[model samples]
Target chain A: MKKLSILVGVVVIVFGIALAMSFKSELCPYVTVSYVVSKGEVRNVQVNGTIVPNSTKILPNNTLMFNLSDGRTEMRVIYHGILSHYQEGIPAVVVGSYYNGIFHAREVLLKCPSKYKVAEENYSTSKVLSKG
Target chain B: MDIGYAFLVCSMLGILASIASSIAYLRGNDTRKIVKRANFAILTFTLLSFFTLLYYFLVRDFSVRYVFLYSDTHLPLVYTISAVWAGREGSLLLWLLYLSIFIVLSTRRLDKVTAFANAIMCIVAAFFNFLLLTSSNPFVRLSFHPPEGYGLNPLLRTPEMAIHPPAIFLGYAGMTVPFAFAIAATYYREEWVKRARNYLLVAWAFLGFGILLGAWWAYKTLGWGGYWGWDPVENSSLLPWLTASALLHGVIVEERKRGMKLLNYALAVVTFDLVILATFITRSGIISSVHAFARNKEAYAYMVLIALSLLLGFVVYIKRKDFFKCYHSYRLRERLIQGSVLIFALSTVTVLVGTLTPLLMHASVTRSFYRHIEIPLGTALVVLLGVCVVAYRESILRKSVLYSLAAGTLAGIVCFALTKLSLASLGVGIFVFSLAGVIQGYSSRKIDLRRAGAIAAHLGLILLFIGVMGSWMYESSYTNINMGVGQSVHAGDYTLKLNGFREVNGNAKFDVVAYVSVYRDGKLVGVLHPKLIIYNLMRSDRIVASVDIISLPLEDIYIAMGGVTPQGVASFEFYVVPLVSFVWIGSILIIAGGILAALQRREEKTRKGVVDAEGEG
Candidate 1:
């Protein structure tokens, strides 16, 4: 019984360490377009912003190009697949890497417009963090 | 609208009175009479409030705010009925209605233990009632009437809404019964544990099936051709069930009562608290999900509920310290059960941590993070499941162990050959071994509901693991395929040919369909028509793709169209997945097993009562 207890304890500790380490390695900060630009060559980060109107173009290969703005700055986003719910002036979270001033997105998630959702005037949380 | 609000307020008052009377009964100052009457009155009032809201929805009363926002005259009758619980306020009302009925049924006869539990439930009922009356009242009236109403979301116009939300809410409400009993068992005897076990099973079953139904809804909607996205809301919904799954194991082991009795009590409180946490995540919009709830400041009421539950759990634990002050050496069976419970707990913690990392760490972790930690843990669990079966070797055939190992090894070989992924093949081996343990439960003639239910549920679990592994590892996807009419493309070894396009103006919407045929080695295998549906009455301009899935004996073919142009050029994604059918089959078996295990046969009840009454006395 004591050995079993020790074994259970050991397994929990090992798994716990693995989970913590992987979580750290995999964590990507949500940043604004300005922050990404300031950082320069940011890898594995997500930027939350509203899609800029009349700035979307569908490449012949069905790749989508659009400009995303966090109000203060705009970054061009190059995505390789459909946005599925893309609309002008809609909030979106684009995840990938930033290099040479363009955000090449591996994934795009659009926040669908709803009567229920409160229209947040800002998507930037970096300012609040620095202030805190 | 006014009447509904009035009934809601009355139900809250009734719930408070019931709590007060239950306390009096526990104090020996009153009979269970007033408690029973108050519960019945609360139920009646809640029923009246819910029906009044449903009446407004059915009548399409545009003057009512909820009705005006969610339903229209053109909405189908079933969907309109479902729309009563579609929004935040309406869904809370639905949850409260189910809670009230369960509360009334549980309080049919109350002793000191039961009366205490009845009080705790009344407290829970009062909290929901208060939320409904103050912040989230579904009966709020509009200042002026509009000519028409904004119909339900195009995404919610399907038959899925009519069932999925309701089932999930029922599961949440059913959880309250066990939570109350677990708290009551803290200072009292073990009687509450036996009673609560059945409720736990039933609630756990409902939650399992509800999640599966949500997955089915997602699959039908064709989001990334994947049923699970590990979204925040999805993970939150899964969190409580994991803890409840722990409690499900804890209850059976705690019955010996050497020690570990407090385990169930603690797990039950945590399970119920996670339900509140799930609510907070879903409605408070603390995390980003495709099923985003609008963030409401008043939804912090649920945080208060969690605080209350925590306080309630500790206060009872402190008061009952003497009851749990004994220790005994654990048997091998008990130790094995403990090991599995620990695994369940770890899985819960991992999910809960992953879900909350965004809020606390200011970082987002994607599906890969979950897949990495969870798959290994799941494989370990499969191994633990095999070990745990040895504790119940009495009911199992000794020969079945050898048979299951052979079967499992064969499965691993086949998996290795098909996917060439060593990890999946390893999973197949352990999963089949554990699955054999489940089969061992059935091969014996002593197959009662409890044994059969456990076997079936575990069998479903093994099948689900196989389905997940196979579907993920073996599926072949061809994306962004643009084909003109009569054009063909190769999808793995199968050739997909776009045959033609047809438009049908159904009563609900205009359906633009693309006919496609699948051929293997130049012989036709199946025909598929994946359609793009544009609903006319939806408030939003959205075109939803209705996916086509053909289930073959060995594999399933899935197709979804992006759109079809006027010139008959079709763009779509084609996918074929091996063993995806096991996900659904496993889900159903798990769900049915939960309900079956909860059933109380006639003879066993009397015998159990006699045994328990003497033990406690």
Candidate 2:
């Protein structure tokens, strides 16, 4: 019984090591452009995109529909992040390589409308009117 | 100037003290001074670390990147405490603190036998504290400070999230006690093994409750109606649980029969080892589950080293001829040993292989490794479990083969008729077998409460299996047209009439409520109000499905609305699941049985003159 147990243990240990070794290389891969990066940095580029209402069920996290006007192509980007309200139809940049035929965006930034300018103008007008 | 560095230094000192004191105490040397110092150091370090993390969260210390990332000023007090464990570093620190606290508590009231136990506790504590200092230190200072921190994960903001990890950590860390006791028992005479059963029972209850709480949290929080997804993280938790459960039962046999001593010891060692391995798999990011931490090489190295040391220690203890000779041997014990080893071996293999297969498949050497290895291994596990059940029953019954076959066949037929399930459903078959095991207890005249609890647990498993199988196989789900107010849709045998959707705005979020009426077979069933909640900070949306369930003894009609489209149509999905309630019912029974088993009468003679000490070494 002891010998058999030992044999089983040895077999499992070997298999486990073999399994670990097999996955070691791919476990930590270099950040490539096409890997949809979420909330992290990649190579040096800062990429961003818009959250579009998706109809496909296969997209588990939902795809971000972005337009690349420079390239004149509509790009469907798959990203994993909590999409904010300003993220839709806002100018954004993605900082990753287009790898495996998909554009991977990392560190998304949403451009906000000029609410500060409007507030400043309103404050000045109110002060001038009060003086008059 | 930062609390992180101070906490780190304190923990490192605590680790040194624990190790030194443990060695001195175990050898019956002058360990009192060092042990006292270690106890105080551990308490001071843990309290300081905990409070510092809490302070970071409460103050919304954006200067500390971790706190800034996981907490915000707007976060509630409950979620603020939870944010302490929402990240990799903080979670590890929490584990360390909880383990140290438990060790200190357990060591305070120790008998002479508990000296060895205390030493083992100190060793385990030292391992964790060392891990804390070396890898994934929560006290690591931020390179740059930010004005405001990122908030916690929207999903983790649930109440269940607050309790799940802590409960799991308590259970995982609690297993160290029995492991320490096992090591301690090896030094003492055979009588210590009998006394260790009570401690083992306590550990078992903790681990079992923790696992259940986790499953409950997952079922409710994950938005997936089913529990037990067999995900790698879930499997890692279950692996220790399975071994611990088996060990709990085996200890009962050991205490009752004065047999299976070696088996009991082996179980103790393996259960402890599995706990470490589970922690490693989860924290080291060997598995790619959402719940697991991201890859951290230092954390991985620390875990591997700890795991290797524990493994080596276990191997040395088991292989030593003196250790075997210390306990009396029986020929009948061989079967139990074989069974235990087989189950343990199979579980270890299944978990290790299942967890690492994805990584292995992705490795450079296995560039062509396209197929999944876990499926075949899982199938093998199922087969082994089947064999174990048969063998266990055969050993107990010792009946004629013909009679056993006849009984099994009759039981199978009755189970089939009762369940009204086809043979194609393997899950149903397994559930039937579990039920049969429960019924088998009726004929055994030596029916005690513990045995009954065990039987109830088996019955619960059967119910759970049936529930999962029924929900998976026979469930009917379909999405209908998105409806407006006064719009109705047909789903399966039910027509869902959309009463209306009302949007309620709150202080921090807005909730879109969908009220719908269900009519099954032209008879009014009920109304369901599902909501789509939009949070303020992240502006993230979550669909909280409100299910109106018509539960029966054999089946359930569960209904939920997907939401109304802009076109004024309400979309609804109705699920007709068989034996769904039984799953939750079974889980509750299993938990209750575990509690009962934990409270089982301790062997009366073993409780004499046991001394409780103050503070663990």
Best by TM-score: 1
Q: Tell me the deviation in Å of residue B141 in model 1.
A: 1.0
Model 1 lDDT per residue over B50-169, tens place: 999999998889899999988877788999999998788888898889999999888787788889898888888888888888888788888899878887776677676578778877
For candidate 2, the share of real interface contacts preserved is 0.02
Kindly report which residue pairs in candidate 1 clash with one another: none
**DockQ of all candidates, in order?**
0.36, 0.04
True lDDT of residue B196, candidate 2: 54
Cα lDDT for residue B94, model 2?
73
Model 2, span B291-385: residue lDDT tens: 12233455455556457646655764666536554253433333544455455555555555555553444211121121123333333333333
TM-score of chain B of each: 0.93, 0.79
DockQ of 2: 0.04
Q: Judge candidate 2 against the unseen true structure and give its global Cα lDDT, from 0 to 1.
A: 0.57
